[model samples]
Target: MNHNVILTCAVTGAGDTTAKSPHVPVTPKQIADDCIAAARAGASVAHIHVRDPETGTISHSVEHFREVMQRVREADVDIVMNITAGGGGDWIPDAADPTRGGPGSDIQTPRQRHEPVGELLPELCTLDCGSLNFGDMVYVNPADWLREHARLVQAAGVKPELECFDLGHVWFARQLQQEGLIDGDPLYQLCLGIPWGAEADTETLLAMRNRLPHDAHWAAFGIGRHQMPMAAQAVLLGGHARVGLEDNLYLEKGVLATNAQLVEKAASLFENLGARVMTPAETRAHLALRDPNTGHVVEKAIETTAGGAA
Candidate 1:
């Protein structure tokens, strides 16, 4: 097992989980507060997604994103903010007309998907590596779309956390890295345990992990009840862990959890497994992330000196 690791809390997701759990943050302020709470609870990073406050549904509004970013920055916590560039890809075909998008379909151009990330320029952002049968609907991320998205993310100078839902997604991500679309050391988020995707099991995680680029920095997360187990699995396999309401709503069976509660639980698991949860500063250095506050890369020289002194 890796002794030192970066723990990330996916504060909220763009899924239909608002009504399932009251703890899922809907408004910009609520999401920001929970992200700050996650940071206080020992998460080095906060994976953020915005929603329509009144409707309690997924949103891709720039204003909503701006509000969340402002609040989190105002809190002045050291959490590495990771915005979602994986929006506007949900496709639920209409029963009446298959060609026409249904009520829930939220497709967008690559530029529309990258708007918030390009404007806000967080420390990190997600790029869903490929399309898959995401439950009833198809989450469409075609090759051309992914290539354009990767190029946009690179131009923004924001590190893309290549989100791989299956083994083939991992292969495609490696292809992107090979094409020089991603900058710095490529980062990957091995997303497992969703409908029709990679299973949340040791064998599946290992299979996907093995396919990653040799020098890639990666993390893994599982949904629902498998969250903690998959996190432990990831850590044992020498990768990082991700936990929050986005991936799991319950702290335990039938027990609803806040973002901080989930993060605290993940931290305890990491500690018990003999892995040290990294601080935000340390995670920034480890991931080579830019300083969100100043919009500049953290100086390697300064980080090295600080580590030596410590």
Candidate 2:
């Protein structure tokens, strides 16, 4: 029943989805352009992930990140940038030798994973709370690693968007809050519908939401076909919504869609449900997020029913 909501468009994810849809952005300019387009289409934040332009494979290069950041920053549109700090955790053991990593294994130290976020200084960064069976491979984010990642985000003075893929992750996120590792008011993203993780259904979403901190500002999203439905559900359950090419690549059955199209559809749903999509400035004040580039608080108090709901 929350009337005010923040819509985030995840431009591109670190998945093998580029070939599946022609609309999926791969190059730095494409990613940045989509970020701007999504903002114009009503998304307040852009959750970004870079990829190798030539191969369309996920990349962690600071050079790629810099190009994308520079384009988005120099753009005239105002969009809150949220960089992923959850990379370098993909581990696939080799079939021939279980002791060695397979072709898809992409693991890095905690600092290596946080390097881009640390150097780029985006307004928000993600911290995956726990390890989970991510489809055929296992995505590892052990307790120790998570603790260290949280500390790194805290030290950067950027908001950590605690990404909880399961109910246990929600519990661990609360633990991080208790341990004082997460700074400022807790900001969480209830990541649903990933393989072997939480299901993308009302029962699961409500169960996870019930366990969140009472005052936490949170958003939720579902992958693939459940994307728009879960976004509408999030609004009904008093939370913000996220949509983009990252989680879904279609406007309808057999229809390819761009990031802006996805955000526009989500915004339509929000308005139809009696909720107004929040702008970047409003989200900044509502979440008390900092300016990543300038390293200063970006809050502007305004009078509205949804001003401080989260």
Candidate 3:
């Protein structure tokens, strides 16, 4: 089992979770505050995805990301901000014409999806390695587009948390490394329990982990009821942990959870498993997170200051 653990809190995902949970952050201010509260509660990193303030829908607005960054900086909390660069790729075929996209379909070019990551310049952003069947819709990420996205993220000096939903995605990620598109030790996020992807279980997570590059740093998370158990499995196998409302909505059987509560629960669980929950500073060092604009390794993990808005 890994003793030193990095706990990442994926705050609000670009999913249809807001309507199900009252605690899901919709506005930029709410998202920012949740990030701060999560950091204060022992999350090493905050995985962020902005939402449309008026409608509580997923958004790829750079300005929204900018506002969240501004608020977090103003709060003086030390959480590694890992933005989501995996949006704008939902495909629901039109009933009238199967060749065309439907009303819920929202596919974008690699450049479109990379817009927020490029502008925000977060230390880390996710790069979904390949496409998969996402519930009723197909999340499309073609090989050419993935290659382009990886190159763009590398050029920006931002570390990519390679999100692998299956074993093949991990293979393609390695191919990217072979093609010299990836920089530094590749970081992987094994996303499990999503509709038609990798199953959320011990064997599945282990199989995925065993295939990762020996030098790579990886984490894994399961959805809904499997969140905590999968986290334990990941940590026990020497990988890190990711937990939050993005993957799970409940703290227990019937209790809905806030982002902070989820982070708190994960931290507590990791500690109880004989692993120390790493601080943001420690996580940066572990991942070698860098500042894209400054061209500097961000080694400073946490700072002591009065708490800001939560």
TM-score of each: 0.95, 0.96, 0.94
Q: Tell me how far the alpha carbon of residue 117 in candidate 1 is from the true structure, in angstroms, after superposition.
A: 0.4
At residue 126, candidate 3 shows an lDDT of 95
Candidate structures ordered by TM-score, highest first: 2, 1, 3
Query: Candidate 2 lDDT, tens digit per residue, 108-168?
Result: 8899999999898888888999999999999989999999988998998888999999999
Candidate 3: where are CA atoms >4 Å away? Answer: 291-295, 298-310
Model 3 alpha-carbon miss at residue 91, Å = 0.5
Mark the regions of model 1 whose C-alpha exceeds 4 Å error after superposition.
Answer: 299-310
In TM-score terms, candidate 2 sits at: 0.96
Tens-place lDDT digits, model 3, residues 1-310:
7778889999989888888999999899999999999999999899999999999988889999999988986886788899999998899999999999999888889999999888878989999999999899999999999999998999888899999999899899989988999886778899999989999999999888888877788889999999999999998988889999888999999999998999889888888989888877677777778743356896644321111111
lDDT agreement of model 3 with the native: 0.87
Which parts of model 2 have CA positions greater than 4 angstroms off? 292-294, 300-310
Residue 283 in model 3: lDDT: 79
Q: Could you tell me which 10 consecutive residues in candidate 2 have the lowest summed lDDT?
A: 301-310
What overall lDDT, based on C-alpha atoms, would model 1 receive against the true structure? Answer: 0.88
